[model samples]
Target: MRSPKQDSAAFTQAPEAVFEAALGVLQNAGNMTLLAAHNGGRRLIARERPKMSNAKFLDIRVEGDAGAAQLHVTVGTDPRTPKAMLDGKANAKVLKNYVASVRGAVDESSPAPASPVADHCLQKKTEVPWADAGQDPEIELDGNIRAAYGL
Candidate 1:
């Protein structure tokens, strides 16, 4: 059997909060279907939508308290058939992008430390969305959950 690809990262937020952010990030990435959500335990199991990919599933687990949290993510591909296996590079890219999105969400939720005027200006300029007038901001996550999560 092939081993699943795995990655972990620590976050300076409550485990529950980080779990919630992760759910949002996964849903936003599109074509992910939640298979199980253990809210009390801060764990979720999901998979790429059938139409999107047939072989990949994701397991996300969180642990820690209000002061700190750790997230463990694993990407597994079905081993019943050799052709269904996912490549290491693809799995690593998925994990990296997911972690970055979750981190960004956490950062956006918390207030940043005070910085110089010029620094703040530059940061805002890069992060701000300059959507066209009268057009809605891009929706990264699809479906009703996007509204429920306020993403």
Candidate 2:
């Protein structure tokens, strides 16, 4: 494990170099959906989570050698609709190839660097008041039930 200071330095330096290498690794993976990726060195570890559904979720992790990296990605399907996979018109084998192509693009190595200006940006916190949910009361009373209860 690296100290905080060491990690910070690794992240601040050339991050893209590592990612490019990892991209090479993923490009060779046979059949898998590109879920997420990670990249770093002795000092830092950067990871990215894939988007979910039309909005879904992708889980991924990577473990790299002192100079290399490893990755774990989980692919899921959407119940509401099939993504990437179309109707019968789409070939099943072609769909598999398509997913492989995307997985190849994922590089579990160095990630994109943060903008220097981001370090200087100030963040503000705000407090919000909570309100109770109001309930609606609009229903016709049953004459028979009302009569039974003499209401």
**Full-model lDDT for every candidate:** 0.57, 0.27
Model 1, 4-77: lDDT tens digits are 67989999888877877887776566566554455565666555544434345577889998899999998755
| Best candidate according to TM-score | 1
Error of 2 at 131 (Å): 32
Models 1 onward score TM values of: 0.63, 0.24
Poorest 10 consecutive residues of model 2 by lDDT?
1-10
Check candidate 1 and list the clashing pairs.
Answer: 28-141
Cα lDDT tens digits for candidate 2, 76-123: 322233445332222333334323433334333333232111101011
* Deviation of model 2 at 4, angstroms: 35
Residue 59 miss distance in model 1 (angstroms): 0.5
